[model samples]
Target: MSKSYDAARDVFAGWEVDTEAALTALSQIPISMHCWQGDDVVGFEKKTGSSGGGIQATGNHPGRARTPEELRADLEFAYSKIPGKHRLNLHAFYMDTDESPDRDEIEYRHFIPWVDWAKEQGLGLDFNPTFFAHAKADDNLTLSHPDAGIRDFWIEHGKRSREIAARMGEALGSAAVNNIWVPDGYKDIPVDRMAARQRLEASLDTMCAEKHDKAHMLDAVESKLFGIGVEACTVGSHEFYLGYAIKRGTLLCLDMGHFHPTENIADKLSSVALSVDELLLHVSRPMRWDSDHVILQDDSILQMAQELVFTGLLDRTHIGLDFFDATISRTAAWVIGSRNMQKALLRALLLPQDRLKEVEENLDWTTRLMLTEEARDLPFAAVWEEFCERNEVPAGLGLIDDLDAYQASVAGRG
Candidate 1:
């Protein structure tokens, strides 16, 4: 070990923290990187539709991956820069086939390419049912649409997506998390909110009627406060999904950008953990609004990691990133975001949680506050650099030249 890391290790030992153990734990945690970032949520379906949901990638960045092959190549490059093995979060619309299948007509065969690629890369795969960016969703309604036909179509799509996810998990020998997030809401005031929610509940029940082995696939439901067009009301609000997850025995997804701007998702982790057996976190940076900016090692992320580690919720939580900044090199965005999350986790792992808890229990607020502040000045950067070296990935400014060269190579991509 370098002299700097050794000194840092000694400093951590003073607080009864094991630097080596923290590094080992950090290496084991896999951050499932979202594939939509590579192509701005534009999947490889033969008939590509517009991104009509609140979701929007607001940049004309060149070199965005246009094909499945190109997207995979981009993802490969991203994985190379990030340390530790990770998983991929794919959308139902990103089918890698020549056949033109509508959302409801999708089958597991259409996603075989993704399964094969994941196996080859030794990565886990997660899935999402695409409920936006299609003709049926143009009115900002889907599963809860007043029209029974539209609701049935989306319900079928959700059912097929769950089946595909189960197969993917079986193939990879990991329980794939099939997270459902629909864009059903109203742009203005709604007359009967009860009816919409009741419809949504019924649709979800029918879609998830076919149960799969827990070892093969796990169901998760995501909620949103509001979106661009659906400003007045979001069908799947936090309260709606939280209660549903508890009652239905499914994981609840908490996207950082999906909540109110002032809300701290870190605080919600422990509260919801009491009810949900497992949680899916979509870590992202949001500026005043759900801007989907690249995440940094900011206070919010650090607090989130600390909560997970301190509450012993790390094992039950699936960490995934959700952001798409098309203005810069998408690969860099992935690398930086993933690494920042790992960095946050590492910092959390290095905390002397036991001592902190003891002090708080004894009502020693002064020591607790002081120790927390002191930790911020520790040699975290030194230990992080060593981690990057051990993982055979670039650290600090070394990534700049690497990403620059990659951008130049892909500059010709139309």
Candidate 2:
């Protein structure tokens, strides 16, 4: 919690920014550092310890310091540059194509080891996600189809994941594993919804029965879609699915970016408020095209008010910042992350919950509230200014100085 969010939270709660816990909670936001790859995260790192450096020459050299020893030091330095307890998200897609007999075998073999490694680094890694392959291939389960092979493939993944988690639990003496993410659903029809439902239902049942050999729960189904290949997944559809999942013992993983164009902000927020179990999630920039997952505190923050409003109403869901930014180097990514979610933290703590329900129930009030912000209107550089101005640059914040310090930075250099 920094100064800006600290003030925002108290005001939202009808209290002044005075209490220590409230201030600490408000000021500290969860930033998901791009721990996917140490060097090539979005192709930002160049050689070791080097960065994109904005304009490629001058600017905040957007690179981390050298070695694992230097990572935290860099992170600490990054904190002086940013702020808060970051809920960093990392990925272990694969080490190399040559690391195993083949892609699938290797992914399964390396899964738990990578998770253990993340824990050692005090981080969490999203499991090998589905709905990405778009299986037009040998029984690939990435796409939607009226095919049994695809569902079978998915079952394999679930089964292997369960088994691996079991082994890891025994070997590690105990551990916590999570299955997280949403996928691009069926594209070309024949997606027997009931079958897909049955498969996942059975799979979840088995996993729960076995306990996955460790403490486990799903974050969210992570509903998203591309309009052309697949019509955008309507927020209402996701809302229905998420509620169903909560009943199944798995929780929702709300990606605020996944809402449809027609989705009411309050409806989306209300969905979260309605869920009962832990609603784990990954936060990133709001996308106009797809899951670009830019930084949340940047242009996409227009979606914040409703998002925070919902989180404020509940205590079950746990939030994490998950980002994907291609424009900057990994270090800059980390700094941007820190600066972005810190505000979300404070904002959540300060939510006008009592008014939230009132606003949610009365769509007009919520609309008026969202429309009041410049970000909600222009949704670009224009509102980013409002974001900074409203958040009020705290002492030693990196992102705040972007304009003046970055004028000659990433400008015109792309």
Candidate 3:
């Protein structure tokens, strides 16, 4: 260990927390870095006017990835800065294809390049079916569309996406999480909410009927409160997905930005874990709206990580990032958000869980509160610096200078 790290480790040792043990636990948890961050969610598909599904990436930062090669290069640079191995989260529209196959007809051959590249990097892949930014989705509907042909088109897309995810898992020797999130809703109050939900239920049943190996592909359904256009009636609300996940035995994806602003998503982990076998967390920071801001080591983030550790749900939760800020260097955004998550996890792992539990069980609320507050001031940074050194990544604000050098050398704007 470096001299500074050794000194910090000794400080943490005084608190009765093993800094090395915390580093080991934090390294084992994988945070799926989103591919969209590199390209501003503008995929390789040729047929796109703009996102009609309330998804808009703000700012036009220079050096945004324009092609598959550039995006992969940016991702590689990002992975090198973040400590430990992590998975890549991809959307269906990002397929490396020149034929420009429509969503319904997209084949696995289009993503072979992605799988090969991931294998070389020792990363697994998670996938999502793109249900927006298409001509068929112009009505703000997809799987629950009133038109039969439009619904069938998206259903077919879902089916093909599952097959691709399964193949990805088999190739990488890891279970690929395939998530379904659609922008199907109305701008005004609908006459019949049940009708729309029933159609969606039927569509999901048909799409999930052909089961892949559980060891290869894990299925998840996502929900949202509202979005840009469809702010009145979201078809796939939290209640809808929660019931469906319990009944169908699928993972329920709880996006941090997809709920009421006042709600704490961290509190929902254990309640949902009781019924659902697994969870897929779309970790993002929301401002007043569903603006995908870069994550920070804020209180909400720390609470979420602590709950994961305190409840022993780390093994059952699939943690993935879903933030896109086009105002800054895309590579730096990746490194910052990813490292913040790791820091939060380290903070969680360093908590004195046994001591806190003892106080809480004995109804010693004062001591419990005091101990928790004191744990926050522990030498987490020291442990984190040592972690970066061990993983061969730059520590702390050191990444800022490295990112600037990269932009000046290789990622300059035209």
Question: What shift in Å separates residue 232 of candidate 2 from its native position after superposition?
Answer: 8.0
Error of 3 at 347 (Å): 0.5
Q: Model 3: residues >4 Å from true position, as ranges?
A: 49-51, 410-414
lDDT of 2 by residue, 1-414 (tens): 445544444443342222345444444434445453223332211111222211011123344333333344344344445543333343323332224222223244555544455456444433433223222322222323346565455445555545554444444443323443424344466435566545555544543454453344233445543333335232224645565566765656566555654444334555555655565555555455334354565433434533654446434544555454434554456566655555444444433345545656787675547634422222122222334444454334445464335423323332
Error of 1 at 294 (Å): 0.5
lDDT of 3 by residue, 283-309 (tens): 999986579899999987999999999
Cα displacement (angstroms), candidate 3, residue 406, comes to 1.9
Per-candidate RMSD, Å: 1.0, 8.7, 1.3
For candidate 1, the clash count comes to 0
Alpha carbon lDDT at 43, candidate 2: 24
Identify the runs in model 1 with alpha carbons over 4 angstroms from their true place: 48-51
lDDT of 1: 0.93
Top candidate on TM-score is 1
lDDT of 1 by residue, 12-121 (tens): 99989999999999999999999999988878878746555767897867789999999999999999999899999999999999999999999999999999999999
Scored against the true structure, residue 56 in model 1 reaches a CA lDDT of: 85
Q: Give, for candidate 1, the lowest lDDT window spanning 10 residues.
A: 46-55
Clashes of each: 0, 10, 0
